[model samples]
Target chain A: MLKLMQNEWMKLWHKKGTWIMVGILVILTAGMMGLMKWISLQNMGGEMTREGMIQDPSSLGGTVLLLTVIVAAGIVASEFSQGTIKMLLTRPVKRWKILVSKFLTVNLFGMFLMLIGYVVYLLLAMLLFKSDAGESLSSWSVWSKSLYMLLLSFGNVFITSTFAFAIGSVFRSSSLAIGLSLFIYFTGSTISALLSQYEIAKYLFFTHMDLTQFETGMMLVPDLTMPFSLAVLAVYIVVFLLISFSTFIKRDVTA
Target chain B: MKPVVELKNLSKTIRSKKIIDNLNLSLYPGQITGFLGPNGAGKTTTIRMMVGLMKQTEGDIVIEGVSLRDNFEEGLSKVGVIVENPEMYKFMSGYKNLLHFARMHKGVTKERIDDVVRQVGMQNRIHEKVGTYSLGMRQRLGLAQALLHRPKFLILDEPTNGLDPAGIREFRQYLRKIAETEGVSVFVSSHMLSEIELMCDRIAIIQNGKLIDIREMSEARESFYYIEATPAEKAKQLLTDGGFTVEPFTDGLLVNAEQHQIPDLVESFIAEGLQVFAVQPHRKTLEDEFLEMTGGGQIAEAYAK
Candidate 1:
């Protein structure tokens, strides 16, 4: 199993698509951080509290992590499209082992990129402006919020990567998977808002994906707790991974 | 000799269409068997079934005395396969691809990897990315991967699909050497009959998902030969008188004589005032036998009962 994992790790690094996705993640994360820092500096004359800025960092990390999901989805989806699955399957390894290897490698890559983005965002935020004039930028609350954001970022990327893997397995086309993933990412909140008047629409995976906001005490809805959202997100992750595994195991490599 | 791989009453169906009929074949160890067929003759499907890639609707594939369906892992462990086009991570170097494959086998060593790379004559370029390698090089790398595990049985589907003449010769020589030196049973499917004739010890011709015939090359070559000579009528009489079966052709008398006996027949014809224009040998190639056994006609007709 360790050898199989090693092989999968080698394959992940060797795939050009993975590196391209990483490059895109770095660029887009840096670009978003720069843009937000510029906007904040331009509005520096107004009152800016340290507490507000600490609260705002979660949203920033959340949004950047969301974009990272899209990038990671493309990386995972291209393997199916390029017919590399055939080569992987023909190896004398179990189907489940192969799936787990890929899942682990992809999440590891996502976590690495998330760390890079977080560091860049924090550096830019600290360099650009001072918070609340007299308050120190280094505090336990600020540190706690940053750690929480990183954990949430990890969970967000993990959930999204698994969902994209499922999409890739079922659709077996990178274009379709990327298109549908982006469609869901960009339109899910709007659709959920429109359907909020209904009773059962709140149970959707998209509705529970922003569970981190609840963790940072930014809940817009009553009675939705951090634990409840995490549990729901965890269940969705398991379901999606199971679906992906089943589809991948049964799929014939016609390509 | 015990057969290395055996398929008994094998059949496959996809979407209510029978892709492979009740096909039976046995390939013995230490022999190179060629799977000869035209396009869509279920050759690829049969190879897939043997390698556990596709499930057979109703059949049993015994690899090294183990059932493919019942003991898939053990059965698959004894076999190596290169089905369809060679698939690899094109971004990685060829050496990396082989190393990745080598890790899948239980006892393969790093030295084995270097040995296979050298055996395939790709040692110098093994470090280059697969995308930069030519199609022939990719094919060689695929073969190297298949042979890396030192499997007792090798199953290849159209292994010479895109090879040039020299490349084909090199591939045939390599296959012969492996089968001889390593004592591995090689079952290769190909449309190139001449190559099969030069390489295979025994061949099975398939058409429209059915096994038509399995015979040794020597036996297949003994069917008949076309012989041409001047004074066809006299030549026919002389051949008949010499205890040989002769059929008159437009320009010659086709003889059912052994390859060595042709010289005697030719000399006899010359002594009897019959000038020999030509005594060309026209034995049926594997292609000709395949066409004849498959009821030479449209592919759909070949499938018809």
Candidate 2:
């Protein structure tokens, strides 16, 4: 499985699009920070400090989700489009193992982007901006808060990409997967808000996708705890994976 | 010789329609077997089942003594496949593409990778991206990847689809060398009957999802010589008198004769004042035999019934 993941990673990095993704992540991270720096320079609203920006890295979520979804959508679908799926599946490795490795590699790519974005954010925050007068940027609470926020931001990326990966594999169309996943990501919260009064809202995956809502004190759905949300997301993720793996392992590779 | 791969009562039914029906075949080591069938005759379906890309609804594929049904990875590890065009990751360098495939099979070392690249004569542009490669170069890279693990059995579907004549000859020689030296079993499905005629030692023909015939290329076929002579009737009479079966051919008479008796017959024609314009050995091509077997690529009468 590790060897298979290595193969997936090698294929992933060899593409010019993947390198461009990383470059975009770094540039966007810098651009967002620069925008924040400029906003602080304008001083139109209340003071925005480096510690505060680091503590809430939700701004990275949209870019990360888009990038990760693009990759997850293509990782399996591109194999079909490129006609390499036959070459890939005809190997000694089992079908499920190949699917799992691709899944792992997609998430790994997402995490790598998240980490790089965070590091860039951290570097610029330290280099170009000052902390609030009484607070140190190196404070343990601030560091933990930023790291935790990064993890929560990644939760949305993880779930969205997995959704895209599942749809991509099952339907064998990258465009459909990317379109549907992004559609869900953009509209899930509003849909959940519309249905929050019903009991079915608690069971809906969209209600729990924004795990950061718990930290932001903005509850889209009332009386939902982190553990319950985690459990619901876990179930959704497992269902998505089950659909991906079963379809991948069983479908005839005519291509 | 024991068979390296066996398809036992294999069948595939998709959407209540039988694509391949109870197919049975065995491929021996050190022999190249050609698979020929018209389009949608289940050649690709059978090959897919053998390589585990498609599951057989019934029966088993045993490769190198391991049943694919029981141990897919173990069975496939000993097999190499190039189905249709060798679709590669055009985004990657040829060497990286090889490395990616090399990692899938166990015990394939970096040295083996380089060895395969050299064998395919891709040393100069091994590091170049596959997108820059021509179709011939991709085919070479495809073969290189398939041979990376030194498989015991190699399966090729239209293996020479895009190669030039020289490349095809070289590829044939390479296949023959591997089959001879390393004792590898090869199964190739191709539409190029003449190419198969030249490359394969034996052929297994399928029509309407049935194995119609399997024959050796080296097997002795009835030899006929086309004799184009002036006054064809006189030549026919002379050949019939010589106890040779004579059949009318275009502007000639086809006489079934042995090579040793050909000179004597020619002498008899000269002595009898028969002008023999052309005398050449006429052998049926694989295409002719294939068409005859498959009934001009139509649905067989048996199936139609």
The per-prediction tally of clashing pairs is: 0, 0
Each candidate's B-chain TM-score, in sequence, is 0.86, 0.91
DockQ values for all predictions? 0.49, 0.82
lDDT of 1 by residue, A156-227 (tens): 556666777678767766566657766776676677666766765556666666656566564434456667
TM-scores for all candidates: the values are 0.88, 0.94
When only chain A is evaluated, what TM-score does every model earn? 0.82, 0.96
| Colliding residue pairs in candidate 2 | none
Per-residue CA lDDT of candidate 1, range B1-305, in tens? 89898899999989998989999889888899999887788888888777756679998999889997787767777787887678778889999999988887778899999999998999899999999999999999999989888899988888898899999999899888888988899998887788888989988888779888888876644546677776777777777887878776667777777777867776777787777667676765666666767766465584885
Task: Evaluate model 1: give its TM-score.
Answer: 0.88
lDDT of 2 by residue, B134-227 (tens): 9999999999999999999999999999899999999999999999999999999999999999999999999778898999999999998889
TM-score of 2: 0.94
- TM-score winner: 2
> Any idea what lDDT model 2 has?
0.92
